[model samples]
Target: MAYCPKCKGEMPQTAAQCPHCQFDFPVESPTGEGARTGFAYSPLADFALLVSMIAATIGSVSTAIGSIVAVFHGHFFEGLFIGPIAFFLQLGMLVTFLRVTKLGEEKQ
Candidate 1:
Protein backbone atom coordinates (compact mmCIF):
# COMPACT_ATOMS: atom_id res chain seq x y z
CA MET A 1 0.00 0.00 0.00
CA ALA A 2 1.01 3.59 -0.69
CA TYR A 3 -0.36 6.94 0.48
CA CYS A 4 -1.67 9.60 -1.82
CA PRO A 5 0.35 12.74 -1.44
CA LYS A 6 -2.59 15.03 -2.06
CA CYS A 7 -5.18 13.45 0.20
CA LYS A 8 -3.07 11.20 2.41
CA GLY A 9 -5.46 8.39 1.61
CA GLU A 10 -4.25 4.83 1.56
CA MET A 11 -4.27 3.17 -1.82
CA PRO A 12 -3.02 0.04 -3.48
CA GLN A 13 0.40 0.32 -5.12
CA THR A 14 -1.16 -0.29 -8.53
CA ALA A 15 -3.85 2.40 -8.08
CA ALA A 16 -3.85 5.09 -10.72
CA GLN A 17 -5.88 7.53 -8.60
CA CYS A 18 -6.86 7.85 -4.99
CA PRO A 19 -10.30 6.40 -4.32
CA HIS A 20 -11.02 8.92 -1.57
CA CYS A 21 -9.78 12.06 -3.29
CA GLN A 22 -9.23 11.18 -6.95
CA PHE A 23 -5.68 12.44 -6.86
CA ASP A 24 -3.85 11.05 -9.84
CA PHE A 25 -0.64 9.18 -9.23
CA PRO A 26 2.38 10.34 -11.11
CA VAL A 27 3.32 8.46 -14.20
CA GLU A 28 6.01 5.85 -13.85
CA SER A 29 8.99 5.34 -16.06
CA PRO A 30 9.35 2.28 -18.23
CA THR A 31 11.76 0.97 -15.61
CA GLY A 32 8.85 0.99 -13.09
CA GLU A 33 10.10 3.93 -11.05
CA GLY A 34 7.64 6.71 -10.35
CA ALA A 35 8.50 10.21 -11.51
CA ARG A 36 9.31 12.80 -8.92
CA THR A 37 6.60 15.37 -8.36
CA GLY A 38 7.79 17.26 -5.31
CA PHE A 39 10.78 18.23 -3.26
CA ALA A 40 13.55 15.69 -3.01
CA TYR A 41 14.23 14.64 0.55
CA SER A 42 17.59 15.33 2.15
CA PRO A 43 19.18 15.18 5.57
CA LEU A 44 18.23 18.81 5.99
CA ALA A 45 14.58 18.09 5.29
CA ASP A 46 14.59 15.33 7.87
CA PHE A 47 16.19 17.54 10.48
CA ALA A 48 13.73 20.34 9.83
CA LEU A 49 10.82 17.95 10.09
CA LEU A 50 12.05 16.63 13.41
CA VAL A 51 12.52 20.09 14.81
CA SER A 52 9.15 21.27 13.57
CA MET A 53 7.38 18.27 15.08
CA ILE A 54 8.99 18.85 18.44
CA ALA A 55 8.20 22.53 18.40
CA ALA A 56 4.64 21.85 17.40
CA THR A 57 4.22 19.37 20.22
CA ILE A 58 5.55 21.80 22.77
CA GLY A 59 3.52 24.64 21.38
CA SER A 60 0.36 22.60 21.38
CA VAL A 61 0.75 21.50 24.96
CA SER A 62 1.64 24.94 26.22
CA THR A 63 -1.17 26.60 24.35
CA ALA A 64 -3.69 24.06 25.60
CA ILE A 65 -2.60 24.65 29.17
CA GLY A 66 -2.66 28.37 28.68
CA SER A 67 -6.11 28.27 27.16
CA ILE A 68 -7.46 26.21 29.98
CA VAL A 69 -5.99 28.63 32.46
CA ALA A 70 -7.50 31.53 30.60
CA VAL A 71 -10.92 29.91 30.69
CA PHE A 72 -10.59 29.33 34.40
CA HIS A 73 -9.72 32.98 34.77
CA GLY A 74 -12.89 33.99 32.91
CA HIS A 75 -11.16 34.91 29.69
CA PHE A 76 -13.43 33.00 27.33
CA PHE A 77 -12.49 34.89 24.19
CA GLU A 78 -8.81 34.40 24.77
CA GLY A 79 -9.25 30.69 25.35
CA LEU A 80 -11.39 30.33 22.27
CA PHE A 81 -8.85 32.08 20.08
CA ILE A 82 -5.78 30.34 21.46
CA GLY A 83 -7.30 26.87 21.42
CA PRO A 84 -8.20 26.87 17.73
CA ILE A 85 -4.92 28.46 16.75
CA ALA A 86 -2.99 25.81 18.60
CA PHE A 87 -5.12 23.04 17.17
CA PHE A 88 -4.64 24.22 13.60
CA LEU A 89 -0.92 24.77 14.03
CA GLN A 90 -0.46 21.32 15.45
CA LEU A 91 -2.61 19.79 12.73
CA GLY A 92 -0.62 21.54 10.02
CA MET A 93 2.65 20.33 11.48
CA LEU A 94 1.35 16.78 11.71
CA VAL A 95 0.19 16.76 8.11
CA THR A 96 3.43 18.29 6.91
CA PHE A 97 5.53 15.75 8.78
CA LEU A 98 3.46 12.85 7.50
CA ARG A 99 3.59 14.02 3.89
CA VAL A 100 7.33 14.67 3.94
CA THR A 101 8.10 11.33 5.57
CA LYS A 102 5.84 9.46 3.18
CA LEU A 103 7.45 11.09 0.17
CA GLY A 104 10.89 10.41 1.57
CA GLU A 105 10.07 6.76 2.06
CA GLU A 106 8.99 6.43 -1.55
CA LYS A 107 12.41 7.58 -2.69
CA GLN A 108 14.00 4.74 -0.77
Candidate 2:
Protein backbone atom coordinates (compact mmCIF):
# COMPACT_ATOMS: atom_id res chain seq x y z
CA MET A 1 0.00 0.00 0.00
CA ALA A 2 0.99 3.56 -0.63
CA TYR A 3 -0.15 6.77 0.95
CA CYS A 4 -1.34 9.73 -1.09
CA PRO A 5 0.77 12.66 -0.10
CA LYS A 6 -1.93 15.17 -0.97
CA CYS A 7 -4.94 13.64 0.77
CA LYS A 8 -3.19 11.32 3.23
CA GLY A 9 -5.40 8.51 1.96
CA GLU A 10 -4.34 4.87 1.75
CA MET A 11 -4.37 3.35 -1.73
CA PRO A 12 -3.19 0.33 -3.61
CA GLN A 13 0.42 0.26 -4.79
CA THR A 14 -0.64 0.23 -8.47
CA ALA A 15 -2.74 3.37 -8.17
CA ALA A 16 -1.62 6.25 -10.33
CA GLN A 17 -3.97 8.81 -8.76
CA CYS A 18 -5.47 9.37 -5.37
CA PRO A 19 -9.11 8.32 -5.38
CA HIS A 20 -10.13 10.67 -2.60
CA CYS A 21 -8.43 13.83 -3.86
CA GLN A 22 -7.93 12.95 -7.53
CA PHE A 23 -4.31 13.94 -7.32
CA ASP A 24 -2.28 12.48 -10.14
CA PHE A 25 1.05 10.92 -9.44
CA PRO A 26 4.05 12.11 -11.32
CA VAL A 27 5.17 9.98 -14.24
CA GLU A 28 8.69 8.90 -14.83
CA SER A 29 10.49 10.06 -17.94
CA PRO A 30 11.66 7.64 -20.63
CA THR A 31 15.01 7.48 -18.86
CA GLY A 32 13.23 5.90 -15.87
CA GLU A 33 13.94 8.58 -13.29
CA GLY A 34 11.13 9.80 -11.05
CA ALA A 35 10.31 10.83 -7.49
CA ARG A 36 10.77 8.03 -4.99
CA THR A 37 7.75 7.60 -2.74
CA GLY A 38 9.08 5.59 0.19
CA PHE A 39 11.52 6.49 2.89
CA ALA A 40 15.12 5.29 3.02
CA TYR A 41 15.26 5.54 6.75
CA SER A 42 12.77 6.39 9.48
CA PRO A 43 14.41 8.63 12.04
CA LEU A 44 11.61 8.20 14.54
CA ALA A 45 11.79 4.43 14.56
CA ASP A 46 15.55 4.58 14.69
CA PHE A 47 15.45 6.85 17.68
CA ALA A 48 12.98 4.58 19.40
CA LEU A 49 15.18 1.57 18.75
CA LEU A 50 18.20 3.40 20.07
CA VAL A 51 16.42 4.39 23.23
CA SER A 52 15.06 0.89 23.72
CA MET A 53 18.47 -0.63 23.24
CA ILE A 54 19.99 1.73 25.77
CA ALA A 55 17.26 0.89 28.23
CA ALA A 56 17.68 -2.79 27.65
CA THR A 57 21.41 -2.60 28.12
CA ILE A 58 21.02 -0.71 31.35
CA GLY A 59 18.35 -3.11 32.58
CA SER A 60 20.41 -6.17 31.78
CA VAL A 61 23.48 -4.81 33.51
CA SER A 62 21.54 -3.82 36.57
CA THR A 63 19.86 -7.18 36.69
CA ALA A 64 23.21 -8.90 36.59
CA ILE A 65 24.51 -6.72 39.38
CA GLY A 66 21.40 -7.31 41.44
CA SER A 67 21.72 -11.03 40.95
CA ILE A 68 25.29 -10.94 42.16
CA VAL A 69 24.21 -8.99 45.20
CA ALA A 70 21.48 -11.49 45.85
CA VAL A 71 23.96 -14.36 45.68
CA PHE A 72 26.29 -12.63 48.08
CA HIS A 73 23.36 -12.19 50.44
CA GLY A 74 22.69 -15.98 50.27
CA HIS A 75 19.57 -15.77 48.02
CA PHE A 76 20.84 -17.98 45.23
CA PHE A 77 17.44 -18.93 43.85
CA GLU A 78 16.30 -15.33 43.41
CA GLY A 79 19.65 -14.31 41.92
CA LEU A 80 19.70 -17.05 39.32
CA PHE A 81 16.05 -16.78 38.29
CA ILE A 82 15.43 -13.06 38.04
CA GLY A 83 18.55 -11.98 36.18
CA PRO A 84 18.41 -14.41 33.27
CA ILE A 85 14.67 -14.02 32.85
CA ALA A 86 14.78 -10.24 32.66
CA PHE A 87 17.77 -10.25 30.32
CA PHE A 88 16.24 -12.77 27.95
CA LEU A 89 12.89 -11.00 27.96
CA GLN A 90 14.50 -7.69 27.04
CA LEU A 91 16.53 -9.39 24.33
CA GLY A 92 13.39 -10.98 22.92
CA MET A 93 11.65 -7.63 22.89
CA LEU A 94 14.51 -6.05 20.99
CA VAL A 95 14.43 -8.83 18.43
CA THR A 96 10.68 -8.50 18.01
CA PHE A 97 10.93 -4.75 17.49
CA LEU A 98 13.62 -5.19 14.85
CA ARG A 99 11.63 -7.82 12.98
CA VAL A 100 8.40 -5.82 13.09
CA THR A 101 10.01 -2.68 11.68
CA LYS A 102 12.10 -4.48 9.02
CA LEU A 103 14.79 -1.94 9.73
CA GLY A 104 17.83 -3.79 8.44
CA GLU A 105 16.49 -5.16 5.16
CA GLU A 106 18.45 -4.43 2.00
CA LYS A 107 16.74 -2.23 -0.56
CA GLN A 108 16.54 -3.97 -3.93
Residue 71, candidate 2: how far off, in angstroms?
1.1
Worst 10 residues of 1 by lDDT: 30-39
lDDT of 1 at 78: 80
The reply for model 2, stretches above 4 Å from the true place, is 1-42, 94-105
Residue-wise lDDT of candidate 1 within 3-104, one digit each (tens)? 999989888988888999998767566434444333444567668888888888787778888888988999998888867787678878877887877875
Model 2 agreement with the true structure over 1-108: per-residue lDDT tens digits: 889999899987778888899999875453232332335235776687778877876787788788889989999887888767886787777677667457354322
Checking candidate 2 for backbone clashes, the offending pairs are none
> What TM-score, computed on C-alpha atoms, does each candidate reach?
0.55, 0.47
Clashes of 2: 0
Tell me the lDDT of candidate 2. 0.73
Candidate 1: regions farther than 4 A off: 1-40
TM-score of 2: 0.47
